[model samples]
Target chain A: MFLWIIQRDLLLAMRRRADVLTTLFFFIIVVSLFPLGVGPEMNMLRTMAPGVVWVAALLASMLSLGRMFSSDHADGTLEQMLLSPQSLSLLVLGKALAHWLVTGVPLVLMAPVLGIQYDLSTDALLVLTASLLLGTPVLSLIGAIGAALTLGLRGGGVLVSLLVLPLYIPVLIFGAGAVEASAAGLGAGAHMSLLGAFLLASLVLAPWTAAVSLRISME
Target chain B: MAINWFKYSSPASFYSLAGKMIPFFSVAAAVLFVVGLYIGFFVAPTDFQQGEAYRIIFIHVPAAWLSMFLYVIMAMWSGIGLAFNTRLSSMVATAIAPTGAMFTFLALWTGALWGKPMWGTWWVWDARLTSELILLFLYIGFMSLQAAIDDPRRADKAGAMIALVGVVNVPIIYFSVKWWNTLHQGASVSLTQSPKMASTMLTGMLIMSLACWMYAIAVILIRTRAIILERERHTVWVGQLQEATQ
Candidate 1:
């Protein structure tokens, strides 16, 4: 049942290619704007690269969070999903997993291109990709709770960022730290492992909370 | 006889109870602050190394301590609201927000003041400072989330979930100094250790901390009363309470 739900979400998302492309485009544009704003000195860009990329990714992921559950809730599909024999927890987890695939994986894949603008080294690019792979799932999982909480509300966009950004601190710290470490020729394995532990913990915790929030908002 | 636990859980009863306790706590807090400040500022001996500049520790350490302490208390009240459907629990959580934010601001402000003298700079990207800044953002986020929503009940539930999630970040903030190779120093006073400083200094710091604790409780009680009244405005008790106050 979980697999079917995941597949269904992916198919639905694929049908809306413009939405996915637009989000990715926004991510790229925001990242590119940072170097232009901060000046194009290679050394300066290298120094600030990890933070700029991580923040842009955070904002882009947050922009995508509001759409995660809103359309379904609005169309009554979420109600039908809730009433289905499949546990709401699994449904929530499945949707979160699918959202991570669509939103997070693209960010991971696009890191190399963005890294080039920051003048990040090949090694730094690899570490940046690895950190994003581990970190963005955490973002999606945590973002799921925010989305569920604000599912039907007006100005949910602003409220979702306010609620979720604090929770993103650990991910931001470790993710940016990993890239910076690799850039400095230090081993980033420990930082990457911490990011993985954080991701695993959030994966286990966020869906249950998201399910509860969904039920409350639905009520 | 069975205690009618649910009776005081009512917003009206809790409002009156909070109102009654506020004056007592305020007086206690005032007394403690006067005595503590006398000991801390006037009588406490100067630091052997950092000199008189260490006087900021009296406020800095206590404010930092309370910032973390209040986040935990907020989470506890939020959990109670979620688990048992208690009427006053969310109000209690709501009441703690401003006080918690104030403590966080105090921590940062005094930290900067202390850092300027000690580190020779007003700011550094130390792990502890960064995490505390995040803590401030978390408190602001909770308050903003509650305010943005129109329906009080839905707002409470949403704020509760955010609070619960944000609680995970508090321990990270507390331990960031220990976890990373950072510029910030570790705790001078910890739960499992003997005092690292002189007995007099430790006494002064602890007393100031106690004063901060009492002040936090008093402020939260006063704020909780306001929350209960605002939330229960349509209720007869609120009308009567307003009439009495007027």
Candidate 2:
């Protein structure tokens, strides 16, 4: 079921590759601006890279979060899913998994390339990728709950940020910390472990709440 | 005797009870604040390191404690409300947000004042301080989300989910920020320089925390009463009460 949902989402995304690429471009542009805003001093840019990349990813993912349920909710597919005998949590999981795959994986893939722009060492770039790879799932998972809750509301795009951004801070902290630690020659292992723990916790917990949120919003 | 827990779950019953309770807590909070301040300003020996500036601890620490405490409490109330579908519990959670936000602001402002004199900076990315700042953001997020949603019931459920999620992340954020801070700056903040707490200083802090607790109860009760009136306005009792007041 999960694989099917992910495949469907990917197929749909492929049909509208522009939207997916827009997200990637948004992230890339946001991260690139920092070097221009704060002069292209190699040392300073390298130091700032972790926070900049994490924050841009956060903002970029937030833009995409609105789409998580809005498309289905608008077309009435969400209501039908809620009414189905198949567990809503699994469906919710499938959707969240698809969101992570479509949005998060791309960001993870793109981050190492951006890291190199800031002159991140090979080790730092590797850690940044590992961190986001673990951390972004947590974002999609938690964002799913926010997306589910805010479905069909006016100005929901902003509302999803208001709901999810604070929740994103932990992931940001650990994610960025891992990269920064690696840049400083400290092992990123502990921070990566923590990020992985967050991923696991959010995985177990978020879908159930998101399912409940879908029911409430639909009602 | 089996206790009927559901009795006060009704807003009307809870309303009258909270009204009766507010005054007692208000008086207690006022008295404790006076006593706490007296001890903090006069009785507690001036810090050898920070001198009079350290007295901000009385307000800062209590506000900081209340800020974190209230989020957990708010989350618990929200979780209970969501799980049990109890309207009053959710209302209590909503009422707690503004107060929690106020405490978070108070903590930040006081930390700024304290930090200025002690650390010679208005703000530093100290682990605890940054975590508190994010906490302020969380409270704002909770209140904003509630305000954005029109249906009060839906708002309540949504707010509850955010609060529950926030509770889970708050610790992770704090620990990670702490790790990040320590990795960057070794022990720079005055609070880290550990002045041995004189007994009188501890007493003042305890008193202030209690005062904040009482103050929180009184304010929340009053706010909850207002919430009950707004929500239950369509009901006969509220309508008749409005008529009687006029």
lDDT of 2 by residue, B68-169 (tens): 889999999999999999999999999999999999999889979988877888987766777777888889988988898899999999899888878864
Per-candidate DockQ vs. reference: 0.71, 0.66
**Segments of candidate 1 deviating more than 4 angstroms:** B1-7, B242-245
List per-model TM-scores for chain B: 0.96, 0.90
Residue B40 local lDDT, model 1: 84
lDDT for model 1, please: 0.88
Worst 10 residues of 1 chain B by lDDT: B236-245
Go through the candidates in order and give each one's C-alpha lDDT: 0.88, 0.87
Per-residue CA lDDT of model 1 for B1-246, tens digit only, reads 998978888888777777888888888888888988888888888888899999999999999999999999999999999999886998899999899999999999999999999999999988899989988999998898888878888888888988898887788878888888799999899879988998877888888899899899999988887777777788776777755468
Which residue pairs show backbone clashes in model 2? none
lDDT of 2: 0.87
